[model samples]
Target: MRTLNVSISDIEYNKFGLKGEQLTFTDFVDMVSKELTRQKLNKCLQLADKYSLSKITMEEITNEVKAVRQDAKNRN
Candidate 1:
């Protein structure tokens, strides 16, 4: 494990809406990861709205997953 001094601007801090609060290394990492995920999700939302993206149900996916697992088991 290691630690290093890093700097962040107030604008970037406010962009994440997390200011003037105590945060550990893991907390900072979690915050950054969630922010990145949120940005990617927003882009996906934009594309979905533009093209009217299709969605799949859990039951539909479950059958595919079962088939894949069975195939892998047969391979073993």
Candidate 2:
């Protein structure tokens, strides 16, 4: 196992009670990584909603919809 030293904000460390505690650094990193991934997924969903493309599928349906939209725009 390798050792890593990190510095976190006082509020965050106090909120999680990680200051001068017995928790392993690996555990802290894992927790932060999971939260980051969750946040990223939420952002992706928000963007999809903004573009009105949330109900898309990978088969012929989504492809046909995209092609039609492009064709309509190109004609104008």
Instruction: Score each candidate by Cα lDDT.
Output: 0.81, 0.80
For model 2, state the Cα shift of residue 32 in Å.
Answer: 0.4
Clashing pairs in 1: none
* Least accurate 10 contiguous residues by lDDT in model 1: 48-57
Q: Candidate 2 lDDT, tens digit per residue, 6-76?
A: 77788878766565744687788887888799889999999989997687777767789889999999999
Supply candidate 1's per-residue lDDT for 3: 68
Q: Which residue runs does candidate 2 get wrong by more than 4 Å?
A: 1-20, 60-76
lDDT of 1 at 52: 59
Residue 6's lDDT in candidate 2: 75
Which candidate gets the maximum TM-score versus the true structure?
1
Task: Give a tens-digit lDDT track for model 1, residues 1-76.
Answer: 6766667888887887875656679988998899899999999888867875536467867988999999999999
lDDT of 1: 0.81
The ten-residue window of minimal lDDT in model 2 covers: 14-23
